[model samples]
Target chain A: MEIKLLTEHYDKKEFRFIEGYKKLGGYETLKKAFSLKPEEIINEVKASGLRGRGGAGFPTGVKWSFLPQNGEKRYLLCNADEGEPGTFKDRLMMERAPHQLIEGMIISAYAINSPKSYIYVRGEYNYPIKVLEKALQEAYDAGYLGKNILGSGFDHDMDIYRGAGAYICGEETGMISSLEGKKGQPKLKPPFPAIKGYLGQPTIVNNVETLAAVKYIIRDGAEAYRKYGTEKSAGTKLFSVSGNVNKPGTYEVPLGYPLMDLINNECGGMKNGAKLKAVIPGGSSAPILTAEEVQKTTMDYECLAQMGSMLGSGAVIVMDDSNCMVDMLKVTLHFYHHESCGQCTPCREGTGWIHKIVSSIVNGEGRLQDIDLLEKIAQQMMGRTICALSDAAAMPTLGFITKFKDEFEFFVREGRSKVKEVRAHA
Target chain B: MFKLSDEGINFVKKELARYETKRSAIIPCLYRVQKENDGWVSPESVSYLSELMELPEAWINEVLNFYTMFNKKPVGKLHVQVCNNISCCMLGARELTDHLCKTFNVKPEEISEDGKITISKVECLGSCDTAPMMQINDDYHENLTPGSAEKIIKGMLNGN
Candidate 1:
């Protein structure tokens, strides 16, 4: 069953406007949030067991609690740079319910006692940026923003910073760097964003969905929110289903929902009644799951992690049998190669090298030894970068090569994609 | 020689004051420059912006070069960016790009002879559900077939 905690009003076009949102009880949560003490609000979030929805799955309350106790300037950054290959939920949330994200950010800013926040959206999101700009104006005109919001004597301001075409900016530190007018590169993490970030003050970067969910957490209280999801991964999550699924869009089900159920029930099964071959249960960075393994898998952090994959940004890309694994890896690696910041040697070089190897193989010039070389290079790239982008490139390279070795070997020997040949013959 | 217009200069000034530090205005300011300078940033504009913004040329150039959105070269009026990432590729995005390139009589990343259309393959634009999509200038046209994509580009060329 779909649990519409955050996406309940998403279907309504009126939800995009402030008056419509208010009619549907939009900023009421902000009012509810202000009534509670900041500490109480943090505690409520802590009790809810809500984790970051932006790929990392970190505990939201724990991250908020990391700020220094003394009164110092702080910053809240909402990571709306949703660039993962198969992820599109954040864009939908922002486009459909701009006020929902704004309301959530205001409440979260109040809980953390930060005076300022910025939604670092990707540059290509021209439509969402326009919507947010109009929504921000509405928020200010209605006095939901600016000084003494809602007469609680709390002052908060929000702005939207557009990111140019860099995927690394989705990283928390990379976002802060970009917001500060730099090249959007990820910073070293010993002094994590919680301790020192965004102009060297305490900073908290949450995903769009994570910040939006804060409104619901305050509205329903912690215990009620926890009632939906499992013990570790609590609350509903929006999974962006794409590729060969009959219906490909964002679906919000509670955590621990079966992956098959999401595919079979929500997405209406494989497109054209095609046979399922593989699934990238998370985003592109996650290791791929065979159709057999996907049967027992659930859509929670722990379950996916145990299966050597992750519920990354809750992006589920379904693949039918007609697709070629080697060709798919080529496309995936090409993205990483282009997006690598080149700040770190391992990722900068490894992404390019792997991409070249895959391209060479796709061109029917592969030595069987090249497959093993791909694995060796991928294994070396992991855990040796300033960001997980190195690993992001490496993980999928390893996943596709290992899980679908037979297809690769056949391609190398026959000098053409096995799946393409089968489709051609059929 | 590349200079922002009066309105463009005023927009830059406002952006400079919008952020905490004037340096934070680089991204938005560069975007404005690209818009005023025919869809791409030129080398001379970096120097012009450096002088105007009172920031170093290296600071402006570094930002302009680091991000892909700021085109380093001149492009067609309609910059048609086709998403050829994983999902789009599975839905025949590569074939779509090929078809557009052949029909438009321009290579990928090259402007058409009339300076109207430039077709380039891009990564995901986060609209995979509507796979095989393309972005022309600032707007996205999704769920595209080769014929439909060609029609949209041609329609734009005809000023429709």
Candidate 2:
């Protein structure tokens, strides 16, 4: 893997500081980028084929290309509001290399001609916000952000906007609402954030990882950047692996890397001798995979899709036989219900209804018909909304209920969780 | 004034530091004070935040009034934050949340009398593995059962 292009100075605590950042060649790539034409940089990104690291996997270059050709005081918004469940890599990126994101943003803003930029961070990331705010002040002092950035004559100002702990705000449009000081809810589409966003200007909302990698994209030409990963999914990706593992932390692997290697080598395998049961390759939004399927999969956008799952936010949640799918599904459903933002009715109500059905099954009050009811509620919730939050909520529920129905039914028939209670019953 | 914790005071100072031009730290500062004051940003604290952000009382008041996260009303001593996100929802957090409200004898977001307990539904707590988790005043109790919920509440009441 590319040791620390994104996580280059992770071992260095000083990298979190401004002086340390400059010493380690931070903003050097930005200086190189400013010399080249903005369109050239965007084209390079497109050619590289780097997808959005935040769940949706939208084409990063294409998202940038959506900006209007004419300059109208555009905005560059960094989606650091990493509120996805099972994801902490963004938080680590922000905390460990705050200046890297700042430098990347400056480069990206320069390319997009966005005079103003904001990093919408999660409120609970109080420390990283402090780290970033500190870094911004340093960037301003260095003239990397404010008037005449790096003598390139590009005037850009960057700020950190804290989100009030809402998961939906992680959505690009939802972030614009929060940045505009409105309730963090997704707006109707047709005017994606690229066309209309953040006070109705041409705004480009890129994920933290996507923006941070821009420096590397500029430093190494598109050909150089595509050297590591598969042709379609170029560049290294960071996977935040958590749950039921001996080593639960963030590890960077090239796209198309073996999923089994990630679990066994990077994570030190499952805790104890317990056999692997299932895997959630992405955040809670992605479908759960049985152990056999996870081994056959690779860590990337296309590979995951082929496996009937997604490489969402790269939050790898590994589960052993000790865990209960029924108990887990209930948790996933409950999160979607709480964070639905009440903007879309189906997501708002359907999430709660699904949670009710799942919990009833878990609590042993479920009826046989409720399993079908779960599928119906999920089907109605999908593709019938303004944003994909509904789909994110529904797809996982459908996957769990359909894949592990026996465990769920077993829980319903017996008033106890199958995984936990079955051992006692034995 | 004398009652704010260090965090609340820091929030006020953070807000007040913006006295030059309307500070952006006002709402978060007020939130900090409310957080310290057992989930109620008092009128006095609002005034303090207003002066800090250099914003008018009307603007500060709207911020205080808006969003359920910033509690203007007094929260109960035992603050319970139930995960209502998709994962937790699929896991049955709603039923347990409803169960909590019934058992506590209070509506969602309501702080019970005598300051014994309060319950509210909140965004995902990120602990999806132990779905159906609740954050009680800061400590997260995951994989909740009604019986376990009752036991925990009883223990909290008995000062356990």
Model 1 reproduced share of reference interface contacts: 0.78
lDDT accuracy of residue A38 in candidate 1 = 95
For residues A159-223, what per-residue lDDT tens digits would candidate 1 score against the true structure?
99999999999999999888988898999987998889999999999999999999899998899
Best-performing candidate as measured by lDDT: 1
Q: Which stretches of candidate 1 lie over 4 Å from their true place?
A: A421-426
lDDT of 2 by residue, A1-426 (tens): 334568878999889988888899887898899889989989988888888988888889999998887857688989988878888788889889999888888888878888888888876566788878888888888778788877788898887777666777788888877666556778898788788887788889999999988878888887887886897788889888767777777888889998889989888888786799999899989999999898799898888898888999998888888778887887677677877878778988999999988878766788888989999989999999999989998999988988888887888777777777522100
**Each model's lDDT:** 0.93, 0.79
**What lDDT does model 2 reach?**
0.79
The weakest ten consecutive residues by lDDT in model 2 chain A span A417-426
Candidate 2 lDDT, tens digit per residue, B1-160? Answer: 7266666666666655532223445546656776767667778877766665466777666545545566667888788888665445544567788887877788888778778787887775555556667878757687788678878887897893
Model 2 ranges off by over 4 Å = A1-3, A422-426, B1-39, B42-69, B75-160
Give the clash count for each candidate.
0, 33
After aligning candidate 1 to the native by TM-score, how far in Å is the CA of A209 from where it should be?
0.2
For model 2, chain A alone compared with the true chain A gives a TM-score of 0.97
Per-candidate DockQ values are 0.63, 0.18
